[model samples]
Target: MRRFHIALAVADLQDSIADYSRRLGVEPTAVVPRKYALFRTDQLNFSINQMPERAGQLRHLGFEDDAASGFSSTHDVNGIEWELFSPADQDAKIPEVYGKEVIRAG
Candidate 1:
């Protein structure tokens, strides 16, 4: 299976989480307090990161593929970054990017 992925920088993580949860009709799958949140649905893998300076901007675009062997990323001609990875790849990287202690399963 492959799911479209979207990552955005938001001014407020909590507010964004609430708003997105309502919009998506589901709560996030995982959240890192004051930092980030990730929501997964049948067709999408959406995430928001607390980034006031970059709020309202797209951080990147990607795909979550079950058959993917590892995580990889590249920039498009327009300089937009695109990533590809499996769920396990993301899980391994999350703790490295965001401290393990801060992540809370949702």
Candidate 2:
């Protein structure tokens, strides 16, 4: 099964971790204070990092698929970014995947 991944940056790591844990009803799967924390549930995979520049902001969006082969990133008209990992032969719907053009591995 493919899982969506969300990564964020926060000013306060521990506090954010605690807050998310409470909200998600579970503890973080892994944490490295002042560095990062990771959480993975059946429905989602999340991570928060202590990056001063992007604090309190989303770092990126990703898709984890065991069958995926390469990667791509794009932005919508609203400017939200997304990254997808998929096999080359797989059919990727552009409009739905957040891109106006087909992105290839560089």
Candidate No. with top TM-score: 1
Q: Write model 1 residue lDDT over 19-93, tens digit each, in one string.
A: 999999998887888898999999999999999999999999999999999899999999999999999898788
Model 2: per-residue Cα lDDT at residue 24: 80
Per-residue lDDT of 9 in model 2: 89
Please report the candidate that would top lDDT against the real structure: 1
Model 2, 1-106: lDDT tens per residue? 6778787989888889889999887787656556676676777767788787888788888775668666768886778787666423223432233334332322
Clashing pairs in 1: none
On a 0 to 100 scale, what is the lDDT of residue 2 in model 2?
77
What is candidate 1's local distance difference test score? Answer: 0.92
Question: What are the TM-scores, per candidate, against the unseen true structure?
Answer: 0.95, 0.64
List candidate 1 segments past 4 Å from native: 102-106
Pairs that collide, model 2: none
